[model samples]
Target chain A: MAEEECLTELELAIQVLVFNFYKYVPRRSLVRNKISKSSLRKMLQTEFPHMLTDTGNRKAADKLIQNLDANHDGRISFDEYWTLIGGITSPIANLIRQQEQQNSD
Target chain B: MAEEECLTELELAIQVLVFNFYKYVPRRSLVRNKISKSSLRKMLQTEFPHMLTDTGNRKAADKLIQNLDANHDGRISFDEYWTLIGGITSPIANLIRQQEQQNSD
Candidate 1:
């Protein structure tokens, strides 16, 4: 069976998240699965243009990365990347939900 | 400006994830933002047909939910749901990466 044939929306979303992560990782980087801090900053600027408004703020981005980088490693692991995305997503989700409720009322 | 007009791919992906959660929630559930275990199970079976082969196994689904329900609240909150998605996505990401590497070699 072609796995992609029956993939659902959630699954596709997961793939998009993963593929985006790989897009930020340097091909020649010794650490294959991790994204460096600078790459992460650029990723936020590019991939999260609307959701993360402070991507241009170096200090804010660095502090956000530090919060996500659980091990205090300057780079972001896949888990850390997931956390970052979730952090950004949660508030947006709430805002969207509130807007939806307001519109329905 | 239409916020939807310029949302990047990553932001869209995040919305997909959040909207999928609401898809399974009952309209009149006492809890506004939490997903019941049964709803979560159905979501896994329907949305992750390929990724979660054990969706047919009730015990396994329950156990998975139990692990994700950090507060033992008997329901999956959005944070727990995000964690669950991350858990499933990580291995699949690694597998896809390996496949890509193999194809390029």
Candidate 2:
């Protein structure tokens, strides 16, 4: 009887995405990068409010915090955080999808 | 203020993984292949019990079904389905990890 103990790479992708999205919040003081924490917060609030649930805003943020605490060091690392917000990898898929949606608008 | 309208590749990866996992389930009759539906059933029941949330065991199975129905076409494609159960791409990682686990056992 063999047990499936490892996560699929897809799960790893999801974990990385979630981690990158929230890596900035608590560690705002540490990561003085090009993207600011306030900017990230605004992006999340406006772009993905569906992620928030029936219990109001706090619970959604709470789940995010738990997911990003991957090392469970009570904090999110810089690498652990950036991959969460990866919306595009290139010039084409990035620009094309947006242009298509805007044309319909 | 630009909004993020597209899912990242990472989300697509998650979608593919969950989709592949359940594609074999409902359309068992159509999928009379090398891997029988019964084997899949045993695998899910044994390998991944953590996926089940246990409302006496029905809701967990229900959630899995919904994820695999990506097109809502009422059928899962062979491509969509196989990618879901991809625990390995064969060879090294597969054999090495298994041997390590067995040695520990």
Candidate 3:
């Protein structure tokens, strides 16, 4: 609720990840607080267009949703969503480190 | 790197999370890319001071680190580190949602 400038970049980043989950969760659902597969696809296509373009298509996105939906409930819960993001970011982080090392060397 | 102004808040946040892990990982070791317990504690205290002050003390931080060291190797890999951050954020996100719902109602 405070001004955005007061928060550290890390703190703000965590907020964005959290807020993105809420932003995609469907309204008026019996499930209440989960993201439907369609919503998950839309979110990837919109919020992560550059990173997830390979999975941006409906079929690829469906596969991604399936992988993340550990419960096989056909929906993406916050935990699943977090796991998905972690999965995506881990390799990128490794690549960045590798590049930095190469540059320094 | 490109200018920060070009990135979405979400994109920047992902970078922060990724960069934080690299920031704490130890260098010049056989285990070249892992975070030792001391590094993890220092990171939590410095980077998450507001949210993790309860674990700021060495003992509590040790306990937290033990729980996160899923492999029980006494150090944190990037995966373990991501899990720790996810664990910390989940409850906070729930609380925020509850508060928002109450306010809206």
lDDT of each: 0.72, 0.39, 0.69
Off by over 4 Å in 3: A1-5, A53-63, B1-6, B29-31, B53-64
RMSD of each: 3.6, 14.7, 4.0
lDDT minimum window of 10 residues, candidate 3 chain A = A52-61
Q: Please compute the TM-score of chain B alone for each predicted structure, in the order given.
A: 0.77, 0.28, 0.76
Error of 2 at A27 (Å): 18
Distance from true position, residue B76, model 2, in Å?
18
Residue A19 error for model 3, in Å?
Answer: 0.9
TM-score: the better of candidates 1 and 3: 1
Say which candidate scores most in lDDT.
1
Per-residue error for A75 in candidate 3, Å, reads 2.3
DockQ of each: 0.52, 0.10, 0.41
Runs in model 1 lying further than 4 Å from the true structure: A54-63, B54-63
lDDT (C-alpha) at residue A9 in model 2? 44
Residue A35 in model 1: shift from native, Å?
Answer: 0.8
CAPRI tier of model 2: incorrect
For residues B33-86, what per-residue lDDT tens digits would candidate 3 score against the true structure? 678877887787677655554223445445657777656687777777887788
